[model samples]
Target: METQKINVAAILVVALTGIIVTVLAASLLMAYQRVPNYGYVKSVGVGVYWDQACTENVTSIDWGILEPGSNRTQVIWIKNTGNTQVVLNMTTGNWTTPEAENYISLTWNREGQILNANQSISATLTLSVSTTITETDIVEFSFDMIITGTEQES
Candidate 1:
């Protein structure tokens, strides 16, 4: 009879421990399920817009005629369309014609500069042909200007 009582007490203790462990696990799960809301929207915005004659669909600049020993300049405006400030990096690709590449010179005023939100910067591009270009030589060529913007660091 004493042994039977001891067995029943041990069983009750085991049952109590199981119930405590289950309750603790359930409480922990409930705590994790409730997510705190800070009411803040998270986003990272980086964008730029070119105000040149070329649009998103059209990417070309026309220099009427390529004359030897002459320089042609075009002004392009860049605007920051993002919510934050950014620094721009500009680069140009190779000319379409390999033969005219050496004779043609391209330059921009603003290569690496900082711009604020909704701010505008004017970049002047000068295309000059060397005097060595002859009348017999074909000088029609085109190049690409790539502008990239990076978020400013704090």
Candidate 2:
């Protein structure tokens, strides 16, 4: 009777070991299942572009032989040669001749505007000389025009 009991205990241990090994093998196989990756992810690139001419600091307006009581209108062409729309802002530096400030007046048609891709806009600058200006007064003015562009949100 003792031999029969020992044999039954050994059989139970072997069965339990086999069950644990089979469960482990099944789990590993499932964890490493081979699946085809039919989908792929690609990255898109984005950038900002600006016109070459607009980026330069070259003079766009030149009024030669400015006379007293004369009004001159010069157009500065702002072009957007980029792939995205942009908001443009213009900044003017202080006049070179402070004495001429009162006698000379400056005005712009549009100081701020929106420019679309591959589009151009004109900014008319009107310079007026007051009648009080004398011939020998020699009113000389120089300033900078800075054009800044910011990309528009979609």
Candidate 3:
């Protein structure tokens, strides 16, 4: 009877071990994978900087590496260099891959906000990569971000 009990114990252990391994494998298969992307920052009628002092000009934004279905945020300082109240607008262009527009999206925290002359505001830009982007063709991608400031007529 002791041998029979030992056999049952061994079977239970094996079953639990198999279950744990299966769960771990599944989690890994469903995990997020890294995808790299980048873009340039261009400002018109204003100054886009990395520092509050506006000493450092923001040239390019490197998202390092992005994970599918995830979002990466970059904070930038926009200082109104003009003498009048200006409204801020943002647009993207020069997409290396047209499909990138479908998989990637850019959004900012400041929308339709008027910036006063000599005033600075910190804005957060979010880059989102769609989970459904399984295309291996997009090994590298690039785009341009154009931030425009229009004078708000008094």
Candidate 4:
């Protein structure tokens, strides 16, 4: 009779342990199953920047009469007229004229810089000429630019 009682007690303990483990596993499974339904919250904002129209405001400079064998500097203004800040990016293209065929160059300021809205920045470029550039003669300068918007979550 004592042996029978001991066996019954052991069986009860084993059954309770199995039931607890099963319940825990089922709870974990349900939690994982519902994870896909959870939604995420994000904040957003609006941004504006200079468009192509801003190019019209660019300042063009001409070094009228630098003496022969002298270097001259020309400063140009770039303005940002948008709601957001922008950085100036300059790109150069090749050009050829009757007098000069292989002496054109262009450059830009540091990359990834910022320009606040309605702010203006200037760049000074130097050119070395073998002969004086006549006031009546024109030297054409052109470049491409872009105004990118700030990144904001939606």
| Per-prediction TM-score | 0.62, 0.49, 0.69, 0.36
Tens-digit lDDT track for model 3 on 31-118?
6869999975433378899998888999999987788889999999999987778899998899999888888889897778899878
Tell me the lDDT of candidate 3. Answer: 0.87
Please name the candidate that would achieve the greatest TM-score relative to the true structure.
3
Evaluated against the true structure, the overall lDDT of model 1 is 0.71
TM-score of 3: 0.69
Supply every candidate's count of residue pairs whose N, Cα or C atoms clash at under 3 angstroms.
Answer: 0, 0, 0, 0
How would you encode candidate 1's per-residue C-alpha lDDT over 85-104 as one tens digit per residue?
A: 77877666776776776788
Comparing 2 and 3 on TM-score, the stronger one: 3
The deviation in Å at residue 133 for candidate 4 is 14
User: Better model by lDDT, 2 or 4?
Assistant: 2
- Candidate 4's C-alpha runs over 4 A off are 1-60, 65-70, 94-101, 108-112, 129-154
Those runs of model 1 whose alpha carbons end farther than 4 Å from true positions after fitting are 1-25, 28-58, 135-138
Name model 3 segments beyond 4 Å from true.
1-44
Report the CA-based lDDT of candidate 4 relative to the real structure.
Answer: 0.49
Q: List the residue pairs that clash in candidate 4.
A: none
**31-89, model 2: which lDDT tens digit per residue?**
45577778644322122223334554344467777888999987666676566777776
lDDT of 1 at 141: 76
Better of 1 and 4 by lDDT: 1
